[model samples]
Target: MNEPTLPTLHWTRRALLATGTAGALSLLLPPVAAAAPEEMDAAIREMFGNGTIREGRVSVKLPPIAENGNSVAIDISVESPMTEDNHVRRIGIFSPRNPIATIAEFHLGPAAGLAQVSTRVRLAGTQSLRVIAEMNDGSLWSGKASTYVTLAACVIG
Candidate 1:
């Protein structure tokens, strides 16, 4: 005797659309072929596209030499008018040496008063800390500083 046939499910428009969107996003992600040192050119392009980026009005403060890479203090402040027309929108921190290039992102608005943020980050070793700020005027500014670390962190399989 033959077994009864199972029912087949058809793909719906919504399901196909969702799947296609997810597939498109997955294509933009870096491959899983082992993490390598991040290149500034690539990271910047991924973050801001081909927009013009300047190097002023932003400051990234880090210890010239960090005794421990596990917890390095980071301070970023942007000089913006902080008005309805001109304000610092957000800030992003990156470390090229880290396994994960993108470190952190902070959002701000005109109500923030001052475009300043302080946080801690992990570093792999001596590397440059890159900070990029987006303004309400659709402009981007960046700043970078080097920090030397003695003991490294985030080295896991």
Candidate 2:
């Protein structure tokens, strides 16, 4: 007796079209919507416990226009001696238009030398990004920059 052959799956024009449509629809619906300005402010306030955020002291560097939104380079440098008496405690990066407003938080100590950090982040769209640095003396310093994304990575409503 001859053995039975297994059935083969084939892709038809109609099936391919349906699959493409479904994929496109999924892109339209993101996992989380972009956070509003007030939401971002509340997040920062909650983290720092309603402290005053002052400008200067902390330097934030980012290109005015990002060709790719998936990986935007960011550099943060705070004016600190990085000693027991005067050092940077932590640094928080926030993006207002991202699905999650809080991007990253870096903890520093005297061993970290100068108060500086470099990292890359994903931006959903063109928005204001904030960098907050807390010194050992319970003082908060922050910097803000407006970035434009030529190509958006995340879908924003």
Candidate 3:
């Protein structure tokens, strides 16, 4: 049996110093901040200008307690007919406590069959999740649900 030879390793002081400087710079940089209410409101208003967000018409389905914060199941359904005259235009998902409050935006057309969607998202912690549905007629509907996360993700202890 032949014995394997270990490869020789070379260390450069300049390379090590450059790597350490880059690491220190990263720590000094400002952390990514979460979306504020004003920003979120502006985004919503931009989507639905001068439109009121009424509840009841839209429904949000999520567990009261999330076992895993990495992948939380979410479902949103709007009470609307998938017709040429009346249909859902888009669906926006928001998490108040996430680094970016706006999680996802799904555009829908009449061919979608129904105004319903299901997906999984990462939650930073226990926070309120909001779903806004925009109709073809420029009407906005909203649904909200609170989720308690047992283990939060994307945050350092």
TM-scores of the candidates are 0.73, 0.77, 0.74
Model 3, 64-100: lDDT tens digits are 9998888899989999888999999999988777766
Order by lDDT, highest first: 2, 3, 1
Tell me the whole-model lDDT of each prediction, alpha carbons only.
0.81, 0.84, 0.81
TM-score of 2: 0.77
lDDT for each residue of candidate 2 in 42-62, tens digit (9 for 90 to 100): 778777767788998988988
- After aligning candidate 2 to the native by TM-score, how far in Å is the CA of 70 from where it should be? 0.7
**How do these models rank on TM-score, best leading?**
2, 3, 1
Model 3 misplacement above 4 A: 1-38
Clashes of each: 0, 0, 0
Please give the RMSD of candidate 2 to the true structure: 11.3
Candidate that would win on lDDT: 2
Candidate 3 local lDDT, residue 95: 76
